[model samples]
Target: MTAHIEQAPLVRRVFWRLAPTRLFADLISKSWMESVIPFVLFVGIFTYLYIANPAFGTIGNLQSISASFSEFAFPAIAVGLTLISGGIDLSVGAIFALVDFAVLFMIGVWGLPTWLAILLAIALGGVIGAINGFLIGFMKTRPVLTTLVALIIYRSIFNLITLNYSEELAVIYIEDPTWNFIATGRILGAPVSAATLVIFAVVAHVILRNTKLGWRVAAVGSSKKAARHAGINYPLVLFLTYCGAGMVTALGAIFYAARLGSVAGPTGQGLEIQALSAVVVGGISLAGGRGTVARAVLGAAIVFLIQNGLTNIGLPGYFTAGILGFVVILAVGADIRWEKNKGKAIEKTLVNPIVFSFASTPDTSPGSQSPLALNDRLKDAEGLAVGLIEGPEDVVVDRLGRIYTGERQGRIIRFSPPYFNEREVFARIGGRPLGLVFDKDENLIVCVAGMGLFQVDQQGKVEKLTDRTTRNWLSILDNSRLRMADDLDIAPDGKIYFSDATDRFDLHDWTYDSLEGRGNGRLCVYDPATKKTRTISHGLNFANGICLAHDGRSVFVAETWAARVRRYWLEGPKKGKLEVFLDNLAGVPDNINRASDGTYWMAFAGMRSPMYDISMRHPGVRLRMLKQLPRDEWLFPSMNHGCLVKFDESGRILESYWDKKAEKHPMLTSMREHKGYLYLGGLENNRIGRIQLPDADQNWTAHDSYWGKS
Candidate 1:
């Protein structure tokens, strides 16, 4: 057990070395990467200051920074909360000033106790905020406009009251020991307000991340219409969000008033602008939705540190504001660009190009003499259910000659034949159904991408079989469920084997899987008898097709991106062993189906190209090309030209068939022989193809070969 545990990480290391996307996918996936640049800048600034000034890294200076940060941190959190709720509160600074003046006036002018005055002042802030909330939420006023108007009105009212009582308030001297201690007390060598700010930030972060209220706020901010459709009460949420921001601003005002021992018009002047700049610089999107309280605090800290450091360095006060403004613009621009081009950025930074050399082949030359040469054999083939089907990627015929195929609309359709004239909706599987087969009871089992394994009963009702396999714990990305479950083939003892092709990319983006060349794919099995699914082997490169061997002792799997086929033993002495069946193929393989003569029919979904092969040798070139070029111009698999090949159980290529022009059938994904006719299907083609197999078995059916004749 110990030996096995130790080997797991080693296996993963080897897997990632062979397939490099594992190195950078997780780094780019998280929202936190946005914080990295600012954090680096913070570190660089701090290091420079500490080296240049001996007093900068001292405990006294650290304490000063912490104390100053507490003043802005709470207000920044207030603004961040409102921003995340898809609204703005520009009156926060006005609210802060009003609260400070109200508390001092009540205590000094009216002889009220400090505690009562503080409570009333805080309540007054909420009341004022509620007025703004009502205007915006209930009265349908725009948030920015309503708040801007509120700021002007509140500031005028504050000035009018303070100006009237200025003479009487100037002579009063109020002092409270408890207020002083609360304002300046120390905990663990840090200021009480600073410690309290940390506690509040942590609590706010938890509430935003782990609560229904936070989810609602995020939904509203992300898209108001979508949030309403999802049944969130937008007006109520907005109202409560503004009310909460008002409460936070009140707390900050109280702290500021106590620390300074005085209140003035300039007490909270320019605070709203500074806090807003901090929010954007800290990685909170001003456009709305995604942000955290931690982000708010980080932004506040950055702002506080930069301001303090500039002051210590004897820089002019105006330079501090100018630098912050520049920072905000740069941060916002960087964020917008990153959001717009993240996918291409990920491909460029993470996916490694496959370095490969395609040696000269006569088959690829002007005049090919190999038996696997391309010709017009497929052009002469006839189309079946031409207008009724679209993109029948895999086609299988039941005993009664009913053709079943998966379509683009996440449904499996059945065409009944003598001539396949009747088209019927079989089942709505709710996923892109790919590889398919039948169980012993004639239930059609399917592999649905983004979903899991499923089966369609005789009544045409679809049932979920198993969507989860044993998670590859060593995998860099989460692999708890089958992602791109592409193909499957059933074993005799009620076990179904399937291929999960690239957990990182979806079926529609299979080209990305090829571009990545990462061994992020796996093979899994579902046992009907046990009602369980498990991984058999993993770390395969784009596992696409699965075919159970004729003797029922092994299964053949095609690693499409790697151009290889592998065999995994299911029974006999070699049980649980895996070995390569075929390698260095002429094209990228897709699906493999059993043939009556004990051979196999494999489809080349795409042929190899010289340019693509050359480009694979330079990962940097591939990555830059992916980012710089349009989707249609990127170097990708030559999917326009493909062919079908017949091979024996020993992995020998028997013969190849092709459509040289590739007009009728550009990409064949799967092919199966039924009686004397070979049925073909393409992933993007609009029709099912049928061609005569002259010397093939006339009475062979996959159903009979597995379950015996009825």
Candidate 2:
């Protein structure tokens, strides 16, 4: 098999090895990609106009466009907010016309001050919105029907008032500085209306994304029943949401009246349809609970550009309207398709397996002179809590000689000493806890597989220390959240150092990480003083074990799939330096811990087989195997055999122990030396093993070695 794999074409090997670059597929699957369609349309439309018409690019024409864009954007945003709350506001156009008439009547006919007229017009819009809010939100009327009725009533009132006062409105024209400036003014080289739109967009975005009210609105929109169950006042949220929409619409109306200073029977007509088209084109989901203020503004810009640009290019009004109508239909169809297939697309391309080259395996047969020679020493080891616990991946002993270990069921189990029969649950952390250690204060610090670092105090209360670190700026995926925190150890200065096994896969999908054979792991440290966690070293292959050296100058970390151990300097002349400590191990290394005699004991969770080694060298075969065969049939490392080894500070293997008969311990994951006994733990074993070391110090405890006696 090895010869055949090596003899395959070089081009095939290179193609398989480059599979790691498929991470781009993951980037394309993010929610931000929803804006791509609208953004592309905006850019394409703008570019076409700039190249086709010289007047479109002038500063004065651009400013006019900006003012018109702002005017249209306000109504679009007003409609978009209602959509986000799972309702449609068809009365937006009517309310806009009524507010415009109110502003014109007060300022021109009643001879009111500009400021007073603007305030009264805005208040009038709010009152109309409150009526709609009361009907649709409190009275439980269908949103579409209630808003349609409001549109008829409000439009009729506007027409009646304008019919009686048209001659009066036309005869009197009051010129006020405030009104004139609002109509045609610039702030920082931008139109006043444009500046106001920018400010409003920023505030709306923050409210929707960063506030509790915004979260409640989204929750209610997603599912009213769910929001009610979660203690959200569903009716109240809708009411306030509509009220806000009304006030915003009125503000836009004020700008429109100031710009034109007149009204007609068709003023603000068909604005509801235009706003709805703008929002849908800008990527606002029609079903609600998903959109942004920026998207709303972008959609408004697209609509305005299409209409204004078509007119400028001599297209008839009916032709421009027809084109926009078609665009809206296409946008809605695309939105539905994207919402349905985004997850499927992401899952299909998430796993990208890469090629790896393996060196020759060393001999570890019985009676061999190699330091990693197998033995039956662990076969006779005594089992503690047999059949009572599941997957005690790591074992630790406190100063009282009490045994502690983590189970696969997200629980820490404790067993009393003497006969070792008394058992109790220490803590229920709700995540598969992998590594266990006791800090100086006797708090149990754990590295939870799917969760991040946690601390369990004497009372068994769990507190999360940190779940996220600084993200890599260049990484396509968000790598800040710890995906799989596998193992950890503390420094003398109270800083906690740990290994994140893989940033890509969670605990259950860890086997995929090995199949990919890529470096997706990093070593991080959590400082107690600053309450911050930061990455120290990255690009490690399944970094599993972490053990601070006995001298406190460096730490040793195991790269499981790489079959190597690394040493990172902490305080010596080589501080901030990382180098390989041991290379080419006989098996896949797991947890590493200190021994009483100043050495470290490491567990091999699985041993490498010839078939698995050959598979690693040929990623193309593995990729095909993954696609064709069932998961259980895929070739993986040999995890049925148990093995442990002891090494000194110089990285020399002193001895090896193995359960050659597979009787007691079938797979070793961790080992700790305390009071002359070696406690064994396994990832899939139902019991903990203990074997006495006659030549070791019987009086030493790990707690005493790290922090001295209390």
Candidate 3:
């Protein structure tokens, strides 16, 4: 076991000890942080009301608040929809009043059935919305100006109709069961309107977050020019958005009419202002394209609670409005400040380095007798596809002896045998492909750095096998999405085992993960029969390479940053167990692959340096260095040297290869032994290296070893 050093200053060392709670910092970096302020305020206000006024906690009062909140939340959501679409609907209040008046008039004067009246009322609101949509979307009119005029016209029409029918409607009462139920019935212990709002909120949230139409709406709102360039119908999306907003507003009107059974001139007079304040306070951006239905509902709840709670506490109505307005102003100011500083906040706190110490490692001096001693064995190795490829991180050989490697440009390059001069593009899979392997079907399975596990057929048709695994329930960030799949190998049962390098950073920012030095990696498996992926192990430190063992009962995994190889048993008595196979390596291991001699060949992508080793023991110092210095000046492993080593199953190093001059193959990431020849690949080099293995088996191939000759 490795020992940790405790030589730092007391205060700094004690402060660094709290680094594990960086998970909370990770949570703070997510988009949900935008809702934090409003949610906290809501909770504080509710707690104060519940303690200050016993009546506020009463079941009757709670039910009343729920119903009222539901009635108001619909308008808030409607206004939010328009705002999210880069537009505004100032006519929501007028539409609400008009719909309410129409519903009551139909039920009382026209003698229409309750169901028919509700449908007609909703349609009326939709028609008004359609009008606003047409004028603003198709007519190229300013949304604020168009909706303001609409509000005026619709409100005037409501006033005129109510003036003619108010007295008559005041005397008429509809004795309808459905209307009564809508007004006061409860479902599963909540008001019907409240229950319906919950369902609608969930659906709207899903639509905004997970659907294509929602994406289009957000795109248009974010940038109309960009959306148009992306072939989106901006006008149609806007029109549909406004139309949907109107229908949602009408839902609120239906519940309001049902509860009151009356309509008046001032029924929905200031509703538009209230809804605008609610959504903005709830964290919806007035500039558009950045809000959720849940936030809208939460805003409505906060506003309603303040309004009702103040009145119940004997505060005057005007004073209540004043306080609500003050809250809205504060919320808007806070939102702007958060938008400006959130990125900086995350940068300052995201990389929480922990104290990580290493045991003594093997020496690789030039004249040392150790098996891992430096040498010039790979200095004269032949280069294949020189200058024709970039960053071939891993190399694989097929049954036909064709050489395959992944390029930094996101294409697989295949070099024909014999002179190895002819080259062709094998596949154009995006993302930096890190590890390559072939299954029993001869299909190439790859681990892409940014993408997830993918398979390429014989014809080079790419198919995504899986990109996500079952999520951890307690994780703050969504761990389901695979962030950086690094290496993979296929099991005999056809299950694909892989390593996700890091959960916190992508390929480009991998250096940051190394600086943090946390266990942010995991081992996952994809079962083709179930079409599902699941995480098998968690808390791996930069899990990189994977290779199924010769016995087929275990697999070797390279924990790159930890400089160790671990064997995970897959069958027999030790199934579902992990044991360290090689420890305290001279360099950071990258990829592990099978050797023709039944041992394993592993590449050391970078050698461990004394400064980096010292820094690991002092995480506080590392954290300070990360925050105070530029990235290029940070202390890290030395990737300037290339090295490879062969190890037997007994955990003894047999021999080592090195490019001591760092000329031909620096930064070796993988090595494959095929037909008595060892092929090398590097993540930072421009070519593939080949050296003849004189004493090795001359006829063995990885293809035949995994799946017998055809």
Estimate TM-scores for all models. 0.77, 0.94, 0.96
lDDT of 1 by residue, 185-303 (tens): 89898988888898888888888999999889888888989999999989888888888888888888887877776766576777888888888888888789988888888887778
Please provide, for model 3 over 1-710, each residue's C-alpha lDDT reduced to its tens digit, 9 standing for 90 to 100: 24433355666655665655576677777778788888998998899889889889888888888987898999999999999999999999999999998998899889999999999998888889989998888887999999999999999998998888768888988888899999989998888999999999999999998999899988988888999999999899989899889999999999999888888778899999999999999999988888889899989989988998988999999999999999999989988887788778787877888767777666788889989888999888999988888889999999898989998889988999887787799999999988899999889999888889889999999999998987877668888989999998888899999999998788888988887777788899999999999998878889998999998899889998888889888999989998888888889999999888899999999999888888887877788898789988988888979799999989898999998988878789998999999999998888899999998899999988887777
* Two-way TM-score contest, 2 vs 3, winner: 3
- Candidate 1: Cα lDDT at 591: 97
lDDT of 2 by residue, 660-679 (tens): 98888999999988899999
The residue-level lDDT of candidate 3 at 84 comes to 90
Compared with the true structure, model 3 gives a TM-score of 0.96
Q: Candidate 3: where are CA atoms >4 Å away?
A: 1-17
Off by over 4 Å in 2: 1-21, 111-113, 628-630
> How many clashing pairs does model 2 include?
0
The worst-scoring run of ten residues by lDDT in candidate 2 lies at: 1-10
Judge candidate 3 against the unseen true structure and give its global Cα lDDT, from 0 to 1.
0.89
How would you order the candidates by TM-score, starting with the best? 3, 2, 1
